[model samples]
Target: MTNERSLSQKWADFRATKAQLFWTGIGCAVATMVVGFTWGGWTTGGSAQLAAAQAGTTARQELAAAICVDRFNAGGDATAQLATLREMSTWERGKFIAGGGWVAMPEMMGKTDVAATSCAAQLVATPAPQAASTAAP
Candidate 1:
């Protein structure tokens, strides 16, 4: 009978220890989650910065291409423009050109022709003086 009594007390103590450990684990998990949520703004900011950087790069590249295409359309010679674009390192060309591909990057979205036509029209309206000078001679 005494042995049975001692065995029961041991079981009770073991159960208490298990319960305490379980609650401790739960508390630690909750604390970690709170800290994660409170201090995780850097991730969001980093993503936004990365997105802005990609957009800026795309805008600059698109603008350059538009200017080149403008020059090409003006005189019907894209050789210089193509050469210039091609001379860029493969990585730069890929980053700047449409199909050469910066689009696949997670930070880069798609392209739009939002300003292309208007810009082309403006370029067409204003012709270079060199052509007129050559014709005069």
Candidate 2:
């Protein structure tokens, strides 16, 4: 009889501990979820768009550099072409490069210079097209 009594007492003790353990586990789970949501960047938006914009900007920069190189290789006045490139805005630079690089002498740039100095400068810098140019000799 005493052994049976002891077994029942142990069972009661385990029940109490189990209740506490269950509640503790619930609390831990809730806490972990709250921390994860708060600290994690799961709520952000438009990351893809931001990345695309960055990539586009980089591509435009590379194109602009190619345009500058073309101008320098033309055997024109490097100093003047460089000055015009520095003075142009990003939009202007893009346009100029897209338009086969700045023309050697535009009528004006923003009404400041008589000819579009930036556009014309590149033309002056590049080498003259030679005759007898062909794919093969």
Q: Following a full C-alpha superposition, what root-mean-square deviation does model 2 have from the true structure?
A: 11.3
lDDT of 2 by residue, 1-137 (tens): 36455777887776457889999999999988788668854443587678887787555544444454565556466555455656776446545543543323232233322123333444445565455767775
Best by TM-score: 2
Go through the candidates in order and give each one's C-alpha lDDT.
Answer: 0.51, 0.53
**What is the C-alpha local distance difference test score of candidate 1?**
0.51
What total of clashing residue pairs does each candidate reach? 0, 11
User: Least accurate stretch of 10 residues (summed lDDT) in model 1?
Assistant: 100-109
What is residue 42's positional error in candidate 1, in angstroms?
A: 11
Stretches of candidate 1 off by over 4 Å are: 1-43, 76-137
lDDT score at residue 20, model 2, on the 0-100 scale = 94
TM-score of each: 0.29, 0.31
lDDT, residue 132, candidate 1: 34
